[model samples]
Target: MRWFSSPLRDCASPRDPSVSRSRVFIYLGLAVTLLLLSYQLILDRGPGIGTSWTAIQGIIVAGDEDRFVPDYVQPAEKELVLAAMQASNMSWVEEHLSDWQVNIYRADAKHDDVGLTVPVNKGNEAMVYLTYIIDRYWSLPEVSVFLHGGRYQWHVDNPLYDSVISISHLNLDFVQEAGYVNLRCAWSVGCPRELEPARYLRERPDDKGHPTAVEYPDRFMELFPRAEVPEVVGTPCCSQFALSKTKIHEQSLEHYVRLQQWLMDTELDAGISGRILEYSWHMIFGKPAQYCLDQRECYCRTYGYCNMTDSDIQNQWVWRGLQLPEGWPEQSESAE
Candidate 1:
């Protein structure tokens, strides 16, 4: 009747101490490796996340004592987002937009250290512009103005084609009211009927083998699958524009991400992909295919060039500030 040790108890011995310790060490190693990878991913995303967080907290990231803000003008809740190439001149932004937050996304891989950098420089300004919207969608300023990196470009709507002048005189009130404003008000380049989708889809040998037009139809469908391809697509040339946060939020972040994904996946060269976006931007921002605003009204509303007549717009007097003709209508308070 002595106590008997069961065979089951004898077989069920504790695991070897070394084996148990080895598993613990293995788990520790895996956890450290995962953490390192996560950190590297955050680094790859660059300063966009950090900047967005700080911006959400109401902090202005860049300001210079040397930059002058006129005493009469109060600080504004606006941001200027630029898409810069390697050789683009950004000095004008520092010199002119002292009161606004400026975010420059460098498209060139060579200039890695300059400004904010896009993940890949595929679709020209389209890549940078879409990236800014997707990144800062959660923490956008009251109004975000997107522009090319150069201070002076032919695409700009200002009389001198100077971004500095256009942005400096930009009517934020109009932007607030309009929701989406094409920075270029002129219709000389792209407007009324810039691209005929049916015509562009036809391949032609004379295009020097560049098949951008031939490729645009498929690309357009990729971007807006649910919508029909319009016969004509038009908007002011280049991608410089502004959007109030309210307008930006009208389309969900997923909408922008899908557009960015199309940019990444498209095989069209940077120039052509960018050109397609150059026309599609207005539609993306809820404007009609023929997004040609009245030239006089656009200048008066978007840039405070009030009372500009068709002749003045034709002569580019909006930017020149020539003497107003007698009995010109008073400047609308809304324009101011």
Candidate 2:
């Protein structure tokens, strides 16, 4: 085997004592240069987290076409997601951000004849979301980020702008470290013991399954007509997460199609649909949902929004109408 100084070692051991010392010095100098050059490789490559070198594709599903009139639809919060991505120092993120696939599903009927059919209600968000995921994003082999109207849902009274600004601060380094980095949006609650008698979708530990998550057998049937009810149902709300396209490819095309068809068939309202989807999402990925706690900060983005305030938790249930048990505390704190 060839060593870095194998040749030098033979030359360094000379027969004459006079030249032996000088030969040793020459060998030592060459050894130092080789060692130093090798060490430079590590020094040049700074601490990089584990992330596929593939380019990242940001998918902004903006269905809210109206914000001018409060009655129509709330203005999309896509600016925050965009602003955050642009703020990232990661050269790849800034250079090759996949063409922003803005699925503006909601259209103005009075202005012009848009797509053949348009559902203006929030319930339609799921339908549009699935279409983009199954048909559009399935082909993308890089990282796929799913952002709701490119906005961040808050638990505190902090301005949406601030919550997003904080999330936007999630630099390239942070994203690379996480496999499927997500936003807590609010507290993580499991199935109510009284209802499902189980905390997870399957018989397992407290991994991703919430202890207080209640079962929604009826909603499960509605969402997946033929599929059986998962042993446990975990509620992970807010469809805001970044996953590699490789992870998504793990799910079968048939699975995506079934999910899309199920959403189309659901007769429930937007609020209920969102709840059912919350739990089902983790199941599709075969993992638990991440609810950010005040102490642990790794589950969410770099910003503090993931560490939701008391008011933020309250708004999730009281205002958002997420199903909480009879004894769950009501929101009293100011959201501001």
Candidate 3:
């Protein structure tokens, strides 16, 4: 009767709204802190998204190395001329290489001509013209000695020889088999071994069971040991390396939208096969761009963006199972 309530009842009846609000605020603060910490961690540890993106920014831009040269070139007289130009005055050549008025051309029509023009000061114009003439004559596939060294040498077919040497994406089989060793030796040590054939051929067993095909056997054996020959020798062996499926299929829904956007932005030709798309993405992304991987959510949350495509996504899945390189990866294959 004197308010007859126990301490527990009294406390429950007069709940402190301020205390409840404080608990709510505490929980909210903790959640925000956790989110910020998670974001920071993602930025630090991921598949080099931002770094790759930054690297790729200039890649797709108008003025790029790709725009200048499409493929690799070997060491030859043209390279020596370029080296001379660089050594003599890099700043001057760099400024004048793309001038429409100057019109610099390579000697090797197939390898040296990259179709770049640069403007230069009038005083340096004669030197540039003389250099172009020298390059053209030296680029002749038959030219043997470079003016600078006076050493005998064969012309390398590719103009982007330096880039070829730096490329790390070459096939492992070629690397292990010493496919490029002869070329390296010839370039550096002036070895006299004949250039390895750029093309591959299949050797078939003759009807009499005799060794039938000896075409380029010496060159082939230099690269491949006799014991490791494939059971079916004549069948061409090529590989297409890509990322795993689980990585490709994660976030299928969102990835689908991004793929559509990329397709729209690039204006890629119609009838683009899935395998080609996958290959292109792999080249650009350095991995499979699909969204189905188990840990893709983690990857997406961290990277903020993913390289995915839809038109060829399903096709890639089917074709990937066949374990065959795409019938034609480069446009040149069709030209052939």
In terms of lDDT, which candidate is strongest?
1
Task: Please estimate how well model 2 matches the true structure, expressed as its whole-model Cα lDDT.
Answer: 0.44
Error of 1 at 317 (Å): 8.0
Candidate 1 lDDT at 243 equals 90
**Model 1: per-residue Cα lDDT over 1-336, one tens digit each:** 849878887779776899899999999999999999999999887776654443445332122222121112122489988888767768878887888888888787443374566666898889988877776766678899998777655455654556788888899988989898988877876777777776665542345564565666778888888888888877777788899999999999778877877787777889899988988888898888888898888888887888977677876624323223232224432454
lDDT of 3 by residue, 1-336 (tens): 475768887877877889999999999999999999999999887676654433443332222233221222232311212312222323433343222112233322233334422222121222222233222321222111112111111222112222122122222333222211111211121112111222223433232421222232332343233323222221101111211222223224333333333333432232222222321232122222221222222122222223424432222122222222333223222365
Better TM-score candidate (2, 3): 2
Candidate lDDT (C-alpha), each: 0.75, 0.44, 0.28
User: Which segments of model 2 are wrong by more than 4 Å?
Assistant: 1-103, 107-124, 150-163, 171-179, 185-215, 221-232, 289-336
User: Where's the lowest-lDDT run of ten residues in candidate 2?
Assistant: 67-76
* Per-residue alpha-carbon lDDT of candidate 2 for residues 1-336, written as tens digits (9 for 90 to 100): 754667777777657877788999999999999999989987876554232122222322232232111111122212112211222232333333333333333322332444211333434345544544554333453444454432323321123322344344443345344434454433434322112423234543443353223335655565566666654443434555555555566777667666765555666665566556655665566454323334234323434336655665444333333332232234323431
Error of 2 at 244 (Å): 1.8
Clashes (candidate 2): 12
- Report how far off residue 78 is in candidate 1 (Å): 0.4
Using TM-score as the yardstick, the better of models 1 and 2 is: 1
Best by TM-score, which number? 1
> RMSD of candidate 3 to the true fold?
24.9
Candidate with the larger lDDT of 2 and 3: 2
Q: Candidate 1: misplaced stretches above 4 Å? A: 1-76, 109-114, 199-210, 317-336
